[model samples]
Target: MKIEVNMTETKSNDSETITTTQQTSGAKNDSSKGPESIYTVPLLKLIKEAQQQHGLRHGDYQRYRTYCSSRLHRLRKVLHFPQGDRKGFKKREVTLDNLKDEKFVYLPLIQAERAWAYAMQLKQESNTEPRKKFHLVARLRKAVSHTIHLEYICQSPLCDARTKLEAQAYSAWMQGTLFFELQEWKQASEKLVLSQTIYEKLASALNEDEQILYKQRVEELNPNLRYCAYNIGDSSAQQDLLNMRSKGGKSELDALIAQTREKQAASLLEVTWRGRTVPVRLEKIRVFLLAYQGLDASLGKANDCDAKLSAYETILLDCKEAIQSLKEDLAAVAKTKVDLQSSQLGSQQYLLSYLTFLRATLTIDRNLVMVDVFQKNFAAYQSGESKKVAKPQEGVKLYEAMVQLSGELQQLQGMENDKKFQNDLELLTKVFKAFRCYYMALTCQGNRQWAEALALYQRAETYINQSEGKKLGDSEFTKYSRVGQDLAHLRSLVNSGKCAAHAQNILGVEDINAAMSGLSVRSKKVYAAPDLQIWRLAVYKLILYM
Candidate 1:
């Protein structure tokens, strides 16, 4: 007998695993043997079997898979970061797929199967009600049979006495319960005498918590009693079957002979065909023959699907490892570089290569390495490329790179918090504002809308609110106020433009204002927009003439 571990594909993915199963022809492989060997099978085959056994439709399987997938991923995240508040991890399900990574998935699975078996075993005698439709019956049947046969020698004797032992066990359990409730040991002992084993085996194969419960139950009833009055069987029955298989003879023919003789002894003509049957350890042949025919039909088609999935998993691992190695190389280059000109140049070029690798890693496979790299580099606000930039008269080319980098960053999507770009923009903004103001004052000293130029200069100061944050200098305020003097000089330029006594000394005040204002009006007429671009071009022209 074999057990089925029914699980969905969503559960498979959440646990970051894949599973498949195949039935090999011989006596026949048990379906229950699959959970441990499913990784060798196709992921789809297990999913397909879950559908047939449970009669789940494609949509139902898909929903189950989705639910399982959601739980698997959410639990993995919570387990990895357990210090947080996702209490939902406590309620997550266990499945064979995630069992590989889980602390001990099989323990709970085996426990459930054992409980189901014990329940059915107790029902075999005249005293207990039996359960049907338990999911773990096949698993418990197979594992328990193997365990029992390992310690036994004569199969038929132990197998025959198995029921009496179970009846005794059940009697002891009921008698103990009755004595506690009724305060009568005689009635309890009569029930106890029906117990098959003086003591039942503790369910040690179960999980720790369940085993504790089993230990407590058995101790309450079976203290100081011998369990094996009859001899326990051994694997001679199993070894004979193995020998028959090697000799190309029917392994289950012996079971058929015994079953027929028993029917003859009981008078087969009077037998009730529909009577409730007891749970028995069947030959592998009997189990396969009893299994639904659909299992055989499905086996042929699913075997190849499992093989392909195994190949795919291997490829996915190879790609992940290759991408990780590329990142390690890029990190190494960033460290231990000494000469700024040569080493920094190499690093700048390497960054471009790293970006290419990162984008490929992301888009080709949708891995997220680049997102982290982008956030870190852009946030730190460093222009490591400056060390390799062409040295110019002072820092002209360096300033140009800063401006260019600013323009590039501003254009990048989802970079609203690019602190470095904001810093550069703030500095460059002031320089342009001061230069703009002086140009306007020199070219349009007595102009009517020198008011507009002064306003533009004042507005440019807003970008400086963050300069204190960058902590450029202790005299940062004084440096910013120097820009205010350009505004004051513009005011004096306007006052002097109208007064000859203020200029050489303001002699022809009205004419000076008229001439300067007329020149400004003429320039605005030539340019069309009354803005800085037009004013700056005009001021540059006046400077050339001077």
Candidate 2:
């Protein structure tokens, strides 16, 4: 048998200085050509070395030395394995005979006239295979190491190929939107255009829900294209007001205002998707656009426009407040748990298990990534930007929520009346393996990460549609809306734009979401209709963040 001496095994503390190197095959280098690796020592050298190391004719000392050397060689070969041997290479096993076959075994060599082999041979029942005799403990340890590595590789393959791509796309989209808001027309236009392109690429790489998110985000941006037209109107309105033209006007400006209103009304805000139109409010800029054209030129007309703008602003503010309040109402519902009986638990457990296994196999952290991604794609949501603005802390980063089901499953596993629960658990394990990829897409869209977010969301939403469908009733819808609205508001306010000083208890919402997410079908249906406004107000009431 041949032995391969990998000299790269550096002693633990001396990991830097020492490294193993295998002697080249069939080569005879100079003995001192930098530390030669000796393996299967030549007969002459082996004798000479043994003689030098020990008085072969003497006591137990020689036997001890031989055993120690042999054992050390074996241990080193076993534990300090080289990397990436998916099919591992084997080492030459030492062949020696006993000098005394009674309490001990010994080498046939005179050096160890009284060596023990029993102690060296691994212990096992006589029926155990020789390989099996080699401790399962060792195999288990190796398996654990391999499992951990596999887990890590399986967990985030998307992040490897595409984290930066999606993040950049989303960041670009967000920048476009921010510029649009700040009225940086040229830059905003360029950014939105870029965002659209990136989103297209992302969409192709994404799943169904992700595709939906891309559509939504694109829709959100579409309406904003008219932002430039609105800004132009704003400039005119401000100019007119600053000039106090109304005090003297009613004459020339009146005609201009009428023309402007006609054009502005004629060119209303509309977004087209799949050849279908979705209406959006351009009210924010409509009045300005109309006023700029001088349709309402008199002081009375200016006053009317002013009154309308003020009223609209108040309405928008009220909506914001209502949305905020809705968020709180949903959060409270999430915090309240509604348990399922054994029968109900079985189905949900099955769903959760299936989703979990699907997630694991797909290699996503959680299914929420799909939702996040889809929202971003649709421009219904954006990803997180900074520390001040919190993002969705669901499935992608981890499947903490899904993983919790394990505890419930374990409890079921021990119960006599949990046959259905047990079955569901098994099903869960199978499907959950395929869900991670979906989760990744969802996360990519959340917290301002649109590209990946959109993709992830698509996959996850598709999963749910396939799995749960319209059964996701008011409770489910409410739960999702609450979290999304809260997140959107929080993010908007982070840079002190809109929705400033949003909810402070991020985890509180998360806890509620998780709890509500777990409620049984009947229990969920049984629960009171959730109120998001009340929830947001509750969060506001308790929150201390300025």
TM-score of each candidate structure, all chains considered together = 0.15, 0.18
Candidate 2, residues 483-535, lDDT tens digits: the string is 32233333222223211212223434554676787789666543343575468
Prediction 2 TM-score vs. true: 0.18
Error of 1 at 507 (Å): 10
The ten-residue window of minimal lDDT in model 2 covers 98-107
Local distance difference test, candidate 1: 0.35
Instruction: Kindly give the stretch of ten consecutive residues in candidate 1 with the minimal lDDT sum.
Output: 223-232
Candidate 2 residues lying further than 4 Å off, grouped into runs, are 1-158, 229-546
Candidate 2 positional error at 475, Å: 57
lDDT of each: 0.35, 0.39
